[model samples]
Every structure is written in C-alpha cells, then in structure tokens.
Target: MRDLPTFDKTEIIRIVRRGYGIRVQKIIPYRHIYRLETNLGTLFFKPFHSKEAKLQLIVKAQEHLKKQGFTRFIPFIPTLNGKPYYCYKKQLFYLTRWIDGHPSNYDNPFELRKAVHLFARFHKAAKGFAPPIEIPDFLGKWPLMFKKRTLELKKCRKNAQKYPRPTPFENLFFKHIDYYIEQAEKAIELLDKTDYVLLSKAGKRELPFCHHDPAHHNILITSTNKAFLIDFDYLIRDLHLHDLASLIIRNGKASTWNLKRCEFLIKAYQEIKPITPEEFAVIHAFMTYPYDIWLLARARYIEKKPWPLTYYIKELIRKTKNEKARQYFLDKFLYSYLLL
Candidate 1:
C-alpha cells in the first residue's frame, strides 16, 4: 500500500473520544484506515472527503434502510453533537462499529452466490429512499457521458498517430485505438437505442438508491456466514441494475470474463429479484461500454498523473487480450437473454 498522509494521533484520538463519547485505547493506522480499539467496541474510522451534503444524504440513506429492517448495512455513528461526522484540520472523518469479518471471497462460488443474493436484498431495502438533498442528473446525462468518453478516445488516437517518436506505450495505444474506438462508438449507439429516461421515470415512484461502488471488497462476510455491505460514499439514485452491472463487470474481469461464472451470477441475483427483459437490455448496454478500456486510455494518454504511463498501457493491453471472452459472454448471455 502507498504511504498515506500522517495525522496528529493525539488530536484524532481526542476528537473521536470527545465527539463520539467513547474511550479510544489505541489507534492503528493501516494505509487510509484507522482501526480504533475503544471501550464501547472496535470502530473503523476513515476519512470523509465528500461534500457535507453528500455525507448527510449517505447517513440519512443508511438510517432509512436500517429503519426498513435492513440490518446488513453499517450506519455512520453520530457524534456527541448528533452530527454524522467530525471535522478536524479541514478534513472530515466518520466512524462505524467495526465488523469482525473479512470481505466476501469472490473466488468461492458459495460466497459469490451469497454476495449476489445479499446485493439484491439490499436493493429491495433501499427502495423508496428520497434524500432531501438534490441528487445529480447522472441518469439524464448517460448518453452525454458516453459521448464524452468516446471523444477522449478519439483525441488519444489522434495524439498517438501524430507523435513522431512515439514511446512503447504510445505504440501499444495506437495499435488498439481502432478497436477501442469501435467499441466506444458501439456503446454510444446502444445508449441511443435505450430509453433510459423512460425507464427512470417508470421507477421514479420507488426509485432505488444504488451502491455506486459495490465491488467484492465493499461486501463483508461475518464469521457466522452473514453478509453485509460497507462503504456508502458513492450511493446515488439510479437503476439497481447499475449495481448489478458493476458486480458482473468487476467479477467477470477477475475470472477473465468466464461465461459460466457471469451466467451464474445473473441467475443467483435473479432468484432474489427477477430482472425484466427491458432491464436486461439496459444491463447489456452497460456491460458493453468498455469503461475500463476508456479509463486506461484516458489515464495513460490524456491525463497527467504520478503513475507511469507504462502501467496504464500494460493494463490496457491485458484488458484487450480478454476482450474476446468478454464479447463472447455478452453475445451468448446478454443477447440471448434479451431475445435479440
């Protein structure tokens, strides 16, 4: 793990103790995580860098879910002043009762199945959450986002083509630019064909708040085989299928887009929440977007960052190698499921 910023340990301890009315015996820092051993119990403390309004919405959403009898989510513990977080040195931090469980092991089929079912249950409980805060128009701008990413890909291709003495990274980028651009254009076409606004409007009455980042690491499995979701930083109002697509894409990458594994995941989730045909089409469109490829291209070719361009280029190449399997999976499962 990269070295994280150093903080005044005494100040943090004092803040936690005073704000939450707990006795913190020790504070162990692991990367960006602060594990506190307190008289009340073990607490996990992490930095809250998001806006206060967003943080408030997250806290309120968790409270709403908990009130709806969803015990699997960890709610933010309020400070002594009834605030959801404590601000020190212009940085916000929040605490939660530490779960004595590891992240769900995606490699284990049984655990993976459980995680899928648990996610569907979460969607069910998260329905009807209307945060007072004004949610962003992310769904309304879906096509625009895809178009912007496609433009970025085009710019990257142009830059790579014009470089007289291109680096190895540039060469690899140039090699696959055509394919990536094609995939991106195809994504935009699919988005144009989808009536996302109508779908969103149809579900407005019971619009589900999605866990924007529902990767396996955010899923906790207790020693007793119970599963819980952590990390609500990116919670937003969207189709629950957004969460499902995120799960399948991330897990499919781990298995090199294993068609059987992807099918199993969809089936496992369906057992809890059956997906309609139209919803399946939306999911397929989302899965076909090649988000990872676009991100890598932009990071390596367009953006200036501390990381070496070689690293991003290598990732792009790795993803490109797995494209065949991903395409096959999409054709076999997504198309067949949509009856297209």
Candidate 2:
C-alpha cells in the first residue's frame, strides 16, 4: 500500500512467456517478492538484493540436504549466466515453488504442540546435513546496539525536563539500563566465533540446522497434520537451545493454553530429541535473553527509527512487568540446569 518502486511488466511477461503467468502482487523486502499466478500453477517470484549472500548460504545449505536426498524444501537455483539470482530493472528476482498450507500462528494449544514437535523433528533430520557457509557474528551487532542505546538514553535524560510530563516508563528505563547492559554483555560473551553452534565441544560436528527465526507464524500445517516451515531467512547454526528459547519467548506467550501449552510443546520436543543436561541447564538463561532483545527493540523506537515512541514505551512497561516470568524460569529451571 505504501509507495513502491515501479516494476517492469516486460520482465513479468518474460517469465510468463515460459509458460508461467505473471500478476503483480505485494512488494516485500529481502526479496521484492511477487505472487505470480500462472495457468500452470501459482508460485512466488523473489528478487534478491544485498541479501543475496544470505540466500546463497541458504541455497548452499540445501545442497547438503540434496546430496543426502531430502526434498522437504525447494532450494534456489542459479540462472544460466551462473548467477544464483536474476536482475530486472535494477531489482533482482528468483522463483520458488509455492507451498500450499496455512500459517498456524499457534493461537491454539493443539497447533502449538504440532509446531514444537515439527521443529524438533526438523532439527533432528538436519543433524547430518552440512554446509560450507560461515556462521554470522552476532556479538558485535548486539554490543554496538547497546552502546548506541546507552548514549541515546543518556542524552534523552538530559533533555527530560523539556517534556512537560515524563511517560510511565521514563523512570524505570533509566533504572534498568545498567542491568540490561550487564545481562546483554554476559550473553554476548557466550557466543563463540563460529557459523553454527558447536554441538561437539571439539568443534567437530555442527549443531542441527536452526530456523534462525523460529516464531510460530512461520509454521504451515497441512490438513494431514504435516507441518511445513517456510522462511529460511534467519537460518544459522547456533545452540539448539537458541531456537528453543526463541520459540518460547516469541510464541510461548501467544499460545491459547499459556503455561500448559508451552510445557506440552517443550515436552513433545524433548521426546523427539532429548535435550542434553548441559543444554538444559542454561535454558532458563537463554529464555530470558529475549527480554533483552525486546529492550533493544524498544530502544530502536526511542531512537526514532520510525517506531512510535508511545507504543514502544507501552511495550517496555509491559515487558518490565513480565520480568516475573523470566525470574520464575531462572529460579525453577536455571538452578536445575545451569547451577546444578
């Protein structure tokens, strides 16, 4: 609905000439994605940008699976010119086989259980799949963001008197900066310089394929109970616990069954591939990391990155109020897993 760059109808026609019909649809980032409806079938046309490198990594990841004969995913193919993607009017475009299924955001407990079990199975299946892609370094990004926020908050405090009345989170925000930064630093230290989680301490075996972004919304459930995970954008190798923690933080609270549903999902995932005692120990700590991420997200708004300051403040207050959940997990699970 917002203003988008005009695309070439000729390019759309070219692809359609090859027996696919073209219809301009939504413009999405990462890929100027288009929904192409052809008489033959419907599929997605995605043009890569500066993001081609990440997509290339994903494509390379598919090679590992293809060699082993897994076909659950449709990998990106290189064009005849040896380019993994195509360019059109200064924009890039590639096509993917459209997967038919509904996105289950796990609003219901049953769906949440299904999604959790599916992720566990997917991780287990990718255990032997190997790729040559280097894991991205997240340590620097987090610290840079934290530092930027600290400075911004400091500056904001200096001008605090200019605003007639301080918002509700105004006081709590200052009080928690040091605490959040300390926790953020602790997490950054734990991240090793690697492409994936070293499942093997000797750095021998790579951790299972991580969906990178493991929100419940990315899951697609077929009528037959099969779940297809779409979106490989954030796929990286990291501690399997990272994915678990992401799922818990982003999707756990949204589940209809609340704590009961979350417990069921975790238990189901454990049954498919048992989590190690060592990994289990830090699960609580990992779960709490999202709160830190949330703080950073809020900071982005406060820094005037297009997010509304009022909404961000409201969310900050809500997350701060939710600290008890993190503390509960720490008291109950962190002690059992990490401090044991």
Assess every candidate by TM-score.
Answer: 0.93, 0.73
With a 3 Å backbone cut-off (N, CA, C), the pairs that clash in candidate 2 are 46-94, 47-92, 47-93, 135-195, 196-237, 281-337, 281-338
In candidate 1 the C-alpha lDDT for residue 246 amounts to 89
lDDT of 1: 0.82
The lDDT leader among the candidates is 1
Q: CA shift at 170, candidate 2, in angstroms?
A: 2.2
TM-score of 2: 0.73
The residue ranges of model 2 lying beyond 4 angstroms of the native Cα positions read 1-11, 15-32, 68-70, 77-84, 127-134, 137-169, 175-204, 207-209, 255-258, 290-306, 335-340
Which consecutive 10 residues in model 1 have the weakest lDDT in total? Answer: 134-143
In TM-score terms, candidate 1 sits at 0.93
- Worst 10-residue lDDT window for candidate 2 reads 194-203
lDDT of 1 at 85: 89
Best prediction by TM-score: 1
